[model samples]
Target: MSDADYFKNMPHDKNDPNPFLAIYMDQSIPFNEEAKAAYLKDCSSRSRQFLLPVLRPFARLMIIVLQLYKIIVPKALTSSRLLHRVLHFGMKTFVSPSANFMILRHFYLGSEVLGFIRDNVPGVHIEMNPLKPTKLEPVKDDLFLIHDLNLYNFVINLNRELREKGTEVTAQKQLNFSSITSSRIPIEQMPRRWTNFMDLTTAIECFTPVYQLFLTDNDFWRATNSLQLDETIGILASKIIGSNDRLALINNKHPMVPLTTLKAGFRLVLHGLATEQLHALLVELKLKQQKEAAISS
Candidate 1:
């Protein structure tokens, strides 16, 4: 069998769940107007009552102060690893768990979509590949949906380039032709946002290349310190690839979960906070909640 055929026919591990796999299959299906309306309504109700509206401004201010401090303070004084750890600890200790949950709730839909895909779609699996060396060390596992031709093309091209340059390429690096599904489309034709979930799956997949570029671009890293690049890229790419046919990967015509002016402003503020800091705070809050539950039980 040819190389592509092998990947297409590769055995799928039944236990693994991949959220993006659902996104891949979702493309072939028609848009569900009722489901979209229900999701938006649920989001609206949650946003209206959450403390996110009130705390967003304060979070924005804190982030600004932190960034300014990093810029103005000498690297020698600010480089203390211990001091950074302590500050992170303090933030984790004080930040309210509810605040973290409210902010992260927007992403929960992805997990829910993955669960649905696992139950409904047979033979779906998540494949991980090591990224090239960049600012981030040791490389990390990038999650990809098996049977996704678009993703397979990306992996195949990336690995081919790496191999030509004498970089060690493993079996995982090559496209599993056996796993390749006919539903896959060209990278440029990939949808940025899914109508069913209103999630930015395609945009996110497109971002893998952009992120790889950023990691290797020394000048960009030095200037921005890679701060808020995730949000920055998402917003810019979404606008540049406007919702349309041909090159347009996203269909903006679908009913989207409304992010009111205030909510958008709040998200902007939240974006200012370092991603790692927010993650740390969320982890700490989860631990605290687990302990509380244990005590109650």
Candidate 2:
């Protein structure tokens, strides 16, 4: 029987013996329950495989909303100005000054997720020609190669490129939002702030095209990388960076490129985490590496 027909006929209820649902429902299966459990597992996996492509569009939308919130929202919500200022100064002194604004924006959730998607998803497949894996290079030596974890950074770059060519966005970024409370019209406060923004409708209209462009870019890069559109790391890196050298090592070259399912996914999610969050993961990775090294020693 066809896979589609099989899934179509499978029971959707919680109590059904549906093998596809079993994978998600029964996480603790010590022993195989069905003769063809492996086949059932494959079906369940395929069902979720489409999620990446289908969700990519929505992911772009969420990212845009998150970026606007970050830029417009007060610092009190994300972090204290003191802490942010300290990090900003540190980043400027230690890393490239180009990365300071991004570091500040990275504190916001929208920028974190954008960084995550760019690194994790097939969205941004950077190429560093002459790829080679060597001993850990000090960040002080090549701070420009470091990743910037800010979503608004991407938006800023996008806007800069458009402006260079003389384009206008009609201040759609300053949209007001309206909120409905309890489905009850108090009538007096009829014009209360619906959303945090004053012109949300305009913002949405402006943001919509930008979101679609990101989705397209993500799809294009991933498709090209998987299909081996370019063998040179330089070309791949250029594809991912687009017109933004302020973020990645657009000038530097790599000897050994990281091109794998796991690496892609890891970079995507890691880039999405906040600075402290990324630091915590880095500590965990360090511990794991030490344990392995000790075992080897």
Best by TM-score: 1
* TM-score of each model, paired residue for residue: 0.26, 0.18
lDDT of 1 by residue, 8-36 (tens): 34455668743333332343332222222
Q: Backbone collision count in every prediction?
A: 13, 25
Where does model 2 exceed 4 Å of error? Answer: 1-44, 74-76, 79-297
lDDT of 2 at 186: 17
TM-score of 2: 0.18
Candidate 1 at 203: error in angstroms? Answer: 21
Candidate 2: lDDT of 293?
Answer: 72
Query: What lDDT does the true structure give each of the candidates?
Result: 0.29, 0.31
List candidate 1 stretches off by more than 4 Å. Answer: 1-42, 45-50, 74-297
Candidate 2: 10-residue stretch with minimal lDDT: 173-182
